[model samples]
Target: MVLAVKGTEQEELQSRDRAPQSATVSPTTGFFFTSPYRSLSTQGCFAKITQPAADGDNLQGAFQQGVQQAFAQARQAGVTNPVLCGAIPFDTRQPSALFIPQQTQWFERQAFMASVKPTLAALPTIVRQSELPKQTQFMQMVADAVQVTGGEQLEKVVLSRLLDIETSKQIDPHALMMRIIAQNPQGFHFHVPLNEGALVGASPELLLRMCGSQFHSNPLAGSARREADPLQDRQAGERLLVSSKDRHEHQIVTAGMRQVLHGRCRHLHIPAVPELLSTPTLWHLSTPIDGEVADRAENALSLACLLHPTPALCGTPMLAARELIAQLEPFERGLFGGIVGWCDAEGNGEWVVTIRCGTVKANQVRLFAGAGIVPDSSPQAEWHETGTKLSTMLRAFGLQG
Candidate 1:
């Protein structure tokens, strides 16, 4: 434990472990976050973290060690089987907004949802609306990405768009989360309270999950808007299934995923063809990959950091895709494409891709969604895809695209 350090050395590590700085939800003291499988609700702060999380493959400052430091401090504070939960930024180099909760409870999916009845309550009226890059600019960014991908230097890049709305009153996050879950009941729903606002979403992609010796990930790419009519919807999915360009975009993600998993896992399984997954607004090509960890010490966060910014989230040839995303994107992603979940002392947790999500503050909400761009990608189609993606949250607010 870090307790062995003496004098100024101990003070330094302790300073790095201070509680996360956060503002309260309008009325609640803590936060509530969830995955498709379970929910984590925290009442107050315990020993929190100040260190930047998971410094790449460098185990010295990565998840396993970070957890040991955090949980060890939790034990000293008299907490039992404590868990750290919060949002990890898209960039690993940034400081992590994680904290050990003084009071933490885990709930089964059905039980938690059963208690949260869907609400018909009207959210605050949106008095103003704005887009980050504007439609034309976003399309041009996609076109540029397409041209870059058409070359050998880059294969694919995922770009995102933002829609900011100012409401007549502060939004009730719990009610909004309920509406979101009611629409996409099977997705990963989360609401993590932050210093300014709350990071909330219902993500369909599982970044990583670990239970005992095994781990699993479901990476999604290539999508088509879901039509209201049954026949057209099926047709849309079928077309996406047969699209050479979409398949190529999807394979780039799977290939990057396999490479990362192969280095830390054994008995890997990734199906050759991706299956279609349907949400209320779109259909996605998804691959369910599973395997046993080669290293017993691999916690959920460690593995997640290693495989993070997957081509599905970032783009292929990871670094180049990121550089381009930074250049073309009008704003910083913050936690948009990162992860939101929790891990306990046992090193098991679920981290879902932060998609179909938004940042909810007093009287406002910022929604985020991204589309993967490939050589044959159409900027207009990409625009529509992202709009459909954003609708998952917009509909929750009783607003339509």
Candidate 2:
């Protein structure tokens, strides 16, 4: 559904900007969450519970307790069907967050209508785009991976690179979000506020979604860049389907996820083969896995916790891949490759893989993308893959390659 932002200039500003208009009120943190699925869009927060040092091993238990506590608080405020929305970092040990929205709004499918066109007009023009890891350095890292393990210790590892774009003016998070929504109508769109900036993106991968005892996950891997020509685009997708390397990479993720869900789900159904899933910029091999939860009490967040940082995002031999990532990558991957979405008192909600996203603060935006590395992976090819992924956000910012 098209969202018509309130026309007043004050309404266009950050939520913090409108707080002063109210009578001396205690400060409260707010969050925004949405998905291509219209039923999932939500904004505003009545009360929020934060666990700054949540235990990684006990994440499920902690999340359950936190949700119950937040629901209790929401009940006292006469709120019903209350939901929690936020993100979990790639590193489970890192501090993560979820917010219980007090007051929220949901939208239906339609064009976003506004008296004034919500254009990218307010965002600063892109002045420069720089890669965090130079091409040569990234190539060497890939070579090191191939040489160190001799192709046996690690089957695949996802190596990521950052693209930092400096702009001419401060970025308006809302405007950026609007533009993203306009461009990628079918994506899981989100705009989450951070202490210093906002995390925004339109992700095509669903990490997990639960409703009652049923659960579903669509994990994507093995990407091929899209082409403008219809014939070439079809050929690209066909190539991805039969590529031995791409198929192997895709298989590892599917098998890992199935293994993780084995004891937790019943009547699990995973396709023997993957199908093609396409975004505007790339085509990916995707598998849809579904099953009924063995324990009805296990909520969406807990299930997401279990499956997050899948081989699709990290790599096989998860611990080894993570260690390699730490030693090789230059910057910290805060919330990227994480999970984002909402869950309610009931164990029903949707969580999506936070890829094709970026962090926007003031006059700068840092975008991230990763390519899975295997025994025969090419560093130059991986670098190009990241470039293709970054284009999803770059195009949204009204910037071109």
Candidate 3:
């Protein structure tokens, strides 16, 4: 939904490859564009601070300032409805610090649901692929980069191409988002898991969303999906728990989180053990961390920003992994591995790591998946790992591949 602001000039801010529609807003105000890039976004102007982290470095203050600046700048230049989103990066590994207020029945007092009739153009049927280099070329470049960075010798990098197909159906983006929320009221949902390919349910985690002072976030560290056969499902959970490679990957993610949250929060609870968590297709060794903010210096989204590019989504020894990723992969990640969520005036919101997802367009849909590559990583296995992840998104779009 395009917003019309009462301003004259428009700022040509950032890149155009973003998820469609999803917005964040305060209860008193209407909806606003939460991020400059929505789904397939990566090139927006991101501010990175040098840090052991600071109290004042947060999303709430930045957003409040951003709103003021946007409107003020608009008035000066004569622009209207300046679409924007603010992100904060915190180095914590716990459940999101954002709190989302309970949606009481009174808030739903009216039959506010309305049909979203879209006059979308006829979507084209097309198959597209990212230009990835050969496995050997990719690995050699990664190895060389790791050596230069004074890091451990790099392992293999997992890569997968999505065979995405588009249908002419115009689904209600917002209603689908709300449906996820209503179904999983007790957990994080509405993550905008794109409807294309094998991925169906967008999320069981709320990356970020807000209503007044409340913020909500659920960062999933582990995953396991229930299999049709009960015994097999149990075996998969066990596999995720005991596999050294998987455990090693999860540890990198969890430890990075601990480093980020150290002094920023209170009543912080870190679990010493990990449990098995499952989705429909796979199982993950999962650990859920929760804590409260002591400084009120940062809002949940800002904190989430710090945790962006975690080892789970990215790879371990972040610098090393990122560098290696740049060398090994042929296409830009865009927003495939970025953050997705919503925020409001007070800076309260949630954002989720963009993973297990895809990008939808008129001509084609691109599915993305990656896995941690370690010494023991097998190229074939890593290939299958990504394939499993891609299936979920395909299911959502009513497509099978």
Candidate 4:
């Protein structure tokens, strides 16, 4: 049998003689990438998906078609289960970067796959701003409105903005990480750099994860730190789970996900309760929703797109809050708060929301963070909460606190 790749110039002529067929590429031999920026433009020859559906119309059908197309491309290229991937823009104002493999490889004997890592810039890091008397007055104005409306019941509504960082050609994502290390060194650090886009974060929230149909989604809501001891950590988690304010916030996210997955998945189980997860400096109210798909009909991207901008990331009233963000947030989210992961033609993949993340271009970069505001939320506290969340992404870059 003749083997070939589909994306590069040389493969085009080579593939003209081959017959088309559907094939499954193993997890070990597909395309892979780690994007850090959410806005840069990227291209892939085969299996590249286009813009997402504005609404959930024909999305299932479209996703199915995409899967078929990917298979077709794979067959012609003589590779089984070619690694396929692309970006879905959420927070950025610009079009997403989509990447398919530029070349295909035969997997007969190699145990490890190889990919090129792109140069990237690190986002500027900032320490917690000292609270000033006037800042409280400003937050008070926002707080009063929230309380009057019952939105103030939320444990902590975080709020943050994008900051600009200088960039240069001799880019060193690792060196830049060292600078951040001087600040916030403790967190779940992650780095994914690609020609199309990039993402770096220490996220506190888990949008959704599927492990052989036993799905797990630990939605983080409230944030507090364990008191400087192991027992204290457990106590902090327990306190967070029981806090009415925290529960209210957790419910909004869990319920929103439930609504989004309604009729699409089966055996959906949501405990009539929440659990507490304590981090180094804060405690969060978290809940895990488990379920299986009635029909393995949807791919991870399609399902994830349906649940984008969850109440945890957006607001309880999703449509309204999205509009508010459009009006209030100065910049677009781009890939921020969007879903990122890998899947195949079967629609099975893992996607995580791009929270606690930033964007990097040639030399410049922008980091973003936000908080949910409700009636009980304190603006000052919310601001601090956002700082905590941003630390996730910053710490990944070794940003100093």
Candidate 5:
């Protein structure tokens, strides 16, 4: 992901090996963050008066305006070319928690991550782990999603479940993020502060990215668990690549993306077929879509507001799918399925689907994972799929997931 840098770009990214000071301090210092970062990002609070819109029903319009306001405020505070980084909630009406960093320094993700691998002072011991919907209830939830039409012929719904873990000690946000990155070493990694707790995870799905007038997205919908044997894992990936049910699910997402981008893009490129993508725990059906926007007038956050909850994250015919999700899932999604990434004042940035993540607050950690349910979805299979997704965060807590 190449960034569309504006000014002092090369000097800044290159001068750091002669820079004034390290701006690579963990995002733990001031405010929190959301989305995935192809590069490390840190942002302070949005200058007090710049809180986002919390109306819950508006699309990206109002929130985009709020972010523009925040950037203007940042300039007033004398912060040069300030960038906003943080989490946006799954529900649109909720406010986005983004901020302009007091300082910005870009890091080549691989090389910088290589120089840091510190461990947690202590990993929290789990006292109890409870699934919100439980196994049977989650299966039923999937079944319900499969059956519901929301008064329309629903093609798909992204159903999610929560795992609430009570720990023996307080969880350190910084330590947990470090552990997740060290163990997995993939996806868009972030640790952002919320009103109470912090949002952290390594997300593998790219929701959308903007570099100048160019944009790219990698949406993943279908998945299978990885196997211990290399040959078995390879076979599993191959099977997933050709799975009929999985392909239908994956197509819904790519279709939804095309629908949104069609009117806005001057040229779009999407493969006729999807390929396989793998993380540490699962194999996924992934399609890479890229194009040039008709105009460079919109910034990253503003453009992302239009494509936040793609069918992969939510479902096809987003409105109907959202209605079904609200009626089924027991917990508020908060920022879990929302957008996570950073956008400079220029709107050149990257955001990953906020999957493979959880929220940490004191002794309690809530992990979330979801599965895309089409009419042909199986309850039992969807149950196992979500569990495989949870394994990413569970491993960070030093648990074998």
Candidate 6:
């Protein structure tokens, strides 16, 4: 792969024939970022920033500084709209990484067309699959929410489980990403290379998208698994729409987002009701919020920082719910519930919640999924919801629960 700066000669970033050994690449080295909606994808690195320990309160400021530095470096190479992409940990205090690609390439429809040609023989076979938070433990965690908090202090908390898939050989990152994109072309698809592995997924939720002073956010909360039978699938979606528990959960996320955007936006419009959105594996309660920001300085990343870890991902009464998540979840949500996307120096970008995602290291792929727990949430139901969610990525790997 050759990466050429706008005004410079093409430079080889990697050999086109070389294949990525793992799906998740180490962010410390170099990486690429792309979205299904955009025509352009970035590759290689011009400048990179690593926040091994980021302060929760100052994450926005940190991102701003990193972006400025990256743009400065990109300007030196005479590139405009250079893309910065990476993942932030679920806990903002943990380390995060972002990269500014040295070169950008435009694709007809998909950014990974050439890389997807790897034969099925090169694809890894799943040797074993294990759930991180076993069914019993996950159910107990859901029980703990009501038992410990009495359902008041913590209204909702999203608890996630990991699915560890051990493969016969290292999975090819590009091929895996292509499969995901092909399966769900309308979703926000991303691939970020880390040092040892990579992060890849197709997300249906948009955390935030900024184009100049206008912005949009589509938050999805309530979910139901898609059924094989057409009649069953329609019934499942209709059931989700009217279920009081699901409606309440969806309301919490919409209300929380409105509160966050109140001051930043000059005018905001949020529908009174949520519409149903469908992905290959699940149906979601989705609300599209649109607004115009008065603060020209606010930019996309800053807005993302302010609204991230939404009730959709974290839960209501933010801090309290975060504490509960820490007490319950056994794994560090390294980039699973975080944000993924790109932004330019002008603050124009789109970021989506890192759900329906997996981390690949060596021959092991760990997929993550979560369910929103409320006062009336059923333990068994939540467990099944997560399984339904994991099916999206699992299917991409040619595996089924």
Could you give the C-alpha RMSD of every candidate to the true structure, in order shown?
Answer: 5.3, 6.8, 9.8, 8.1, 5.4, 5.6
What local lDDT does model 3 show for residue 171? Answer: 45
| Candidate achieving the largest lDDT | 1
Runs in model 2 deviating more than 4 A are 1-30, 36-38, 41-43, 52-60, 110-122
> How high a TM-score does candidate 2 get?
0.87
Model 5: per-residue Cα lDDT over 86-147, one tens digit each: 77788866656665555555656656666786685559789999998999999999888877
What would the TM-scores of all predictions be?
A: 0.91, 0.87, 0.62, 0.71, 0.89, 0.87
List model 3 lDDT by residue over 1-401, tens digit each: 11223312234332122222233221112111222122221122212111222222354454334444443443344222222332222222211212111110111201222222322332222343342444454455434433443434433233334444544454444433344223323322223322231121244333444333343334444444457888887887887788776676566667777787666766566576677755656676766677676665455445656566666666656666666666557666655665555443245555666565555443345666666565655555555566677666554443332
Kindly indicate the candidate among 1 and 6 with the higher TM-score. 1
TM-score (C-alpha, index-matched) for candidate 1: 0.91
Model 4: per-residue Cα lDDT over 1-401, one tens digit each = 11223354434422212312223222212232222211111123453444343442235464445555655666565544444454456642244443344333322111111221222345444333332223454366446436534643332223346555554342355454433332323322334444433565545555555545555566776676446678877777777667776677777778878887877787888877877665545677777777886666555555666676677777756656666556545466766766555554445555566666666555556677666666667777776666666565455444533
Q: Taking the candidates one at a time, how many backbone clashes does each contain?
A: 0, 8, 65, 47, 12, 11
Give the whole-model CA lDDT for all candidates, comma-separated: 0.80, 0.75, 0.44, 0.52, 0.76, 0.76
Cα error, candidate 4, residue 263 (Å): 1.7
**Residues 35-58 of candidate 1: C-alpha lDDT, one tens digit per residue:** 666666666666556466546344
Candidate 4 vs candidate 5, lDDT winner: 5
TM-score, prediction 6: 0.87
Misplaced by over 4 Å in model 1 are 1-29, 54-57, 62-64
Q: Which stretches of candidate 5 lie over 4 Å from their true place?
A: 1-24, 30-38, 46-60, 120-122, 149-152
Query: Model 3 TM-score?
Result: 0.62
Tell me model 2's lDDT, rounded to 2 decimals.
0.75
Sort by TM-score, best first: 1, 5, 6, 2, 4, 3
Tell me how far the alpha carbon of residue 163 in candidate 4 is from the true structure, in angstroms, after superposition.
2.9
Residue 145 in model 3: lDDT = 39
Q: Counting only residues 3 or more apart in sequence or on different chains, how many pairs clash (N, Cα, C under 3 Å) in candidate 3?
A: 65
Q: What lDDT is reached at residue 200 by model 6? A: 81
Please list all clashing residue pairs in model 1, or write none if there are none. none
